[model samples]
Target chain A: MKSSEWPLVIFSLAIQLSAGIMVIYDLFILFPMYRSRVAFPSKYHWILLIALGAALVGVIFSFLHLGNPTNAPRSLSNIGTSWLSREITGVLIYSALLMGTTILHFVMPSAGRSLKWLVDLTALTGVILIFIMSKIYMIPARPAWNSVFTPLGFYMAAIVMGASLLLLFQINHGSWASQKSLAILTISIPVIQLAILPIYMSWLGHPDFAGGKGLAILLHNHLIAFYLRLVLYLLAIAFGFWAFFTIRSDTTQNRLLFAPALLAWASILAAQIVDRLLFYTQNISPEGF
Target chain B: MSTFGFFCDTSACSGCKTCQVSCKDKNDLDAGIRFRRVYEVVGANWNKTDEGAWEHDIVAYNLSIGCNHCENPACVKACPTKAMHAELDGMILIDPNKCIGCRYCEWACPYGAPQYNKLKGIMQKCDFCRDYVLEGKPPACVSSCPMRVLEFGPISQLIEKHGDNRSVYPLPDPSITRPALFIRKHPGAKLAKKLNASIINREEVKE
Candidate 1:
């Protein structure tokens, strides 16, 4: 189980990032555009395509996690009862909706306002996808994962990642007012995450479930990784604030903001990656699974 | 419906490896893959008497487990493919052809009953020795137990005879899966929990 767990770490993070980006791209980009406050170049929607590409990468590696993937289509058979099945189904529907939206953006460039509904649909599915994905891990068998922190960690990562990536994307675009909102979002989720760290750790220290052992494993075996993720979060926060202050209404200063924005994105991407790896290490099943 | 299951007399199990060995041999399982496992749970507390002599409170027991064919089979519910499913009699079995070998069922099963067949890329576990059952014989683990401490039959009969005690020490809460296993606890089982006993052979038995 340990040996095979790494692929899932990659698979979950990639899929979640893709879902988050699709979602943020909608709220941060689409809604404003729909309100006539800003006009994004048709090329801007391709960020959704980039998100789709990450999802494709996630799907590819997810197969690596399977012992036999030829039967993957059958993975959807138990959707009536299985979260795993629903998750797989969600991925398919999300990717398809995103793909349809992206393709329409290119094929029917004049259909912009008409296609807003489609893009909105894609984004809604992404949210559902993340929820279903989180639900898959909340089963009772692994109490370490069956907690509030699991979904919290997941949603926060998506928001942080999406905001940073979108902040970087929107730095040179969007109305100055919307840019402020994006910058604030980029800076705040990580702050909230930082605040949650000690509390999450304390939750793990309890004897209920295998949390005590999970905490022990975290402090003993993965202490360095834990510290590394913390440092990354701090760096992410610093960079996020740096990027936020760098954002100015003046279009010329947008060029100056790119450095801090890109740095913030990089820092956050690294933190979330390390955070996800640490999440898997907590699989400390009850005494003996 | 048969609702086939196992009954273990924990008080009589001598921590012998025979049931574990026989199951492996009968299944032709590769190393590290086990259909039945014996868990040696041991715990201890030490105190000094006024006479300066050391006194000990030690608890030890063996728990033999296979899949309980849980009525609320989490594996079946967690399985992406319908690979792991329950039959009409409430016995859980994996349909290898449908299994994607995702190993999700492994995480869902509390008893660690499902074993990943790395070579086959599929999950495998005790089917209550279906061939032998049909032939009116006990599963290999039960027949080979030197203490005659293991039994297999319809779970209803076993629960009636064993007095319906499945939430024994060291085993997880049976309510999670409602596993069909029935047990007769060893006297020390309660003390094992109080002393925080742990399985000593984790490496050998872990998937």
Candidate 2:
């Protein structure tokens, strides 16, 4: 991949990770147990902060991807047609909602309950943002990226990274209500992502899809990066399993879960980065050799 | 709308690259940047005769291409800043002032027309020589072709003169962008079904 696209790799991964975490938190933790648990608000606060921080960093990386960062404000001008414009608008809206939610949680915790719609809004926007982000690469010109696999891969990265980070947070905070179920769920995400690898690779190799030259480029020039991405995915899955078992086995709660948790997070995040890099590198446009 | 387009006669092209040079010279493009490129599409196979003599069947042709100024320009559709746009004449243009230089248009274009200008830090491509066209003068590449193989004018006129046959070996399906390009095929032009045909000038035209 061109070194210039590193920023985009980081940008997509970070934002999708942020969105994934929000979706996981809302679906698993907030919606089900928030009313019964007093600590839910504080947990939500920290989670929102993490998501927002990631999204903000993603925005910064996106700016770095541009040759003229000063002109980025005009990026939303083509929302009528451009997926990039839609993506920018989606992320900005999500970030703004997240900021508002975080502010409400800190400034007036009591008002946060009434402003639950804001959190829901943020989560919805975040999900839509991820979809739009994927759509940006679904160009008809780039045969490598113009497929169902692109969006599927993007969502998988989001879910795996998000869930991994959330599990780490939960373990560190000693919140054990649904940790087992969450771990089981999170562990499955990477497995599912891994499962789709073969299909994506096969599609890329097909003569009707990426064509002969495209396959040659993948097998020769990007072979190392592609295998490394696969290895990273496996490593992430292995770490996830280890973390899940550790969480399950530790009845006394005295055992150190930090190592596995950190490893899982790092491995999954690294896998996502590698995957994003491959996505950019393997983009063989229809007219490109 | 008067849609501007390109017409290339692959049969007459000599692969001399005079168009490429003229374009670079006129635009002052950098070393790796080329607005106009001539791709050599080649196919070859050997056959054994009944008399035990080997016969070679080889086909080769040059495709001098620039921006097609597509009727459904994907670059314009993908440009987040609307920097890639279509004028009243339907010639796609890049406005450096509005461009963030994200290269989204570069990726979206099937013709590989949008080029990143590192010196200017923006996307650049043929604007159908807007300044020259406005003055009723041909584009540099069109005027400088030593083989007289390239032509440009309104899409309707080009089609009327040349018919609508834009597909060539190594080029993607023209229906994708509905490129306003027309072509007079080389007598030995390789068909899309010829899986053996390959673009030989890939490294030379890489941008």
Candidate 3:
């Protein structure tokens, strides 16, 4: 691919990442905050709306990667037989549900638990949309994407990436951690991601599914992507271990732990982006990879 | 009165992609946007047979595809904005203004015809060159194909003209989407009745 294609590739990766990550935020972070009675931070709502906006922007930007702009609506006509069509319909429905819930929750705060059901419904809808999106790429005809494990990996990777992004934002805002205890929780997220990485890769590289274009991207694509993933995984494990050990120690400086924690988080973000790019590039469809 | 359709003769299609090129030119398509594409379906093994006896039973078929203009188009139903519409002539179209940069249609199309424009923040697709059709001329793709493999007219007339050739096969069958485009297989390549019966039985058993 030329340098011209890089922007489009990055944009596409962002869209895939946002679709997965933003849904988790809606389900885990934002909705939970609203459901709880404890006063935490008003910033959460602003952050979520921003995330939702970003997700929409990400989706729109990815369209620039397509060959044509005018004929895009024709995609809707084939939903009866196409997974892509289902994904489109699902995304639209979820977006409507989310928008409705968001408006009602913020604009009409007195709506109370009635809006909770709407949130619940939106969350459920988002989950189904994400699943459909994953399946769109998981056609059995394409050996590279045929595995059941790929979709789960995508969902998990989204959470890992999204949480890390939100984590960074929280850290910068100084609202994420007041003491070392909160820092420990932040560190654990990447650690879980590190553990999940190997399991997902093992599933992806199973003997029955190994050696296709998709497998090859992860296994042998470029020296850079492979090395980047390795470094990211190692950083995640190392910092996770260090945070667990040093977070409790009085002598350990917060700055020392914070730096590596941020680095490990960044590395995971990079790895997931690389993985998503490889996913699209390795697809040997009728258009060729 | 204007349910448009395509009758493609696989026996005559040489995979020149004239139809594909014409569709692109007619629509002023962006780079890499193809409304029609030809596919070759290579069937049975030939390398295993002896050289003299090795008659390659390759039923190479060219698929000139655009919107199927189905009675129930998945794309139209999926569009939240109702930007995609099925015309009375059975042509599927999209109004770019109403498309909110959402790509629901892209995912909806099994044949991958709709191309999303990031610049305009909308979707676009072939309109069957309705201008030419209104002027009593065939669509650009139909006229441009050098091999004359593509025949476009009213759905009923075209079906009546060549439906009984016993070589044509429409895509995805009726159950999946009921796509209007028809595919004609090469002559002498049709499955024998006994072979077809056995194949149907095997499929039935597997199902």
Candidate 4:
């Protein structure tokens, strides 16, 4: 991949990671179990901070991708037809709602009913943000990314990375109530991602899908990166399962869980970075073929 | 709105690439960037005749291409900024001031028209030589061809003159973008069924 595209890879992953964490946090942590068990308001602050920090970093990286960052505001002018414009709009809406919800949670700690609505709105916007993000890559001219697998791969990355980060935070805070579920989720998401690999590869190799040039690049030049991406995902799954079983078997809530959790997150994030690089580099314009 | 368009006669072109060179010179394009390109398509294989003599069923022709300034330009639809916009004369031009250089239009265009100029940090393409056309002068490519294979005029007039035969090997179906450009295919041009003809100058044209 060209060095110029690194910022895009980082930007997309960071934002998706932030969105995924927000969705998982709202569904698993905030709404169902935590409201009843504990009244710890500080945890909400930390979760919001992590999500916002990642999102801000993503925004910064995106600016680096632009030739004239100051002119980026003009990108929203074509939202009627351009998916890129819609993606920018989606991210802005999601970020604004997320900020508002975070402020509401802090200002009115006892306003449970009101806060639930805001949180749900933020989570929904995040889901839509990811959808728009995937749509931006579904260009008909570039056959490598013009498939259902592009969106599926993007969502899977978001879920796996988000859940892994949340698990790390949970371990750090000594909250083990939902460790088993989170662990199972983290492990299973990558497996689901792995299940789609063969299908994606088959599609890439198919004559009707990418034409000969795209197939040649995938099978010849980028074959190693593709296989390495699969290996990293498998490693991440193994680490996730091992961390889960290890934490489950140990009744003491040992301090050693941190290492495995961090490892699992790193492997998953690395795999996603590699996947994005492949997506950008192996793009074969149908006209060129 | 009335639109200017190109008419190329592949039957007369000799693949000299003067059109491509003159376009680069006129635009002052940097190395590795060609606003216009001449593609050499070649298809041949040995065949045994009924008289038991080996014969070659060979086909060869040239296609000089730039932006077609399509009626339904995907680049315009895909551009996030209004940087890529159609003018009053139906010519698409990129405003560098508004452009963020996202390169999304590069991926959206099937003709590979929107080229990223890394030095300029913006997308660039043939604007159908808007200034020249406004002055009632032909585009650089149209004027530079020694064989007089290239012509430019109002799309309606060009259609009347050229009869709308745009399909050629390696070009996507014209219905996709409804490109304004028209072509007069060479007798030796490969048919749709024989589109497996290799592009002879792949390295030169690949951006």
Among the numbered candidates, top lDDT falls to 1
Per-residue alpha-carbon lDDT of candidate 3 for residues B6-44, written as tens digits (9 for 90 to 100): 777777887777787878788887665666666544344
Cα lDDT tens digits, model 4, A90-196, are: 88888888888788777877677777777778888888899899888887777688788888878888888888887777774534666666777889988988887
**lDDT against the true structure, each candidate:** 0.84, 0.81, 0.57, 0.82
DockQ (0 to 1) for model 4: 0.69
2 or 3, greater by TM-score: 2
> What is the descending TM-score order?
1, 2, 4, 3
Model 3, CA-based lDDT: 0.57
Poorly placed runs, candidate 1 (over 4 Å): A1-3, A37-40, B48-54
- Span of 10 residues, lowest total lDDT, candidate 2 chain B: B190-199
Fnat of each prediction?
Answer: 0.88, 0.81, 0.01, 0.75
Candidate 1 lDDT (Cα, 0 to 1): 0.84
Per-residue lDDT over B1-207 for candidate 4, one digit per residue giving the tens place of the 0 to 100 score:
338888888888999999999999999899877778888888777778999999777788888989989988988999999899998778888999988888888888988788888777788999888788779899999998999999999898998987977777677888878888899988876552354566778787974
Isolated chain A: TM-score per model?
A: 0.95, 0.92, 0.71, 0.91
Best-first order by DockQ? 1, 2, 4, 3
Task: Please give the ranking of all candidate structures by lDDT, highest first, separated by commas.
Answer: 1, 4, 2, 3
Clashes of 1: 0
User: Which candidate should be chosen as best, given DockQ against the real structure?
Assistant: 1
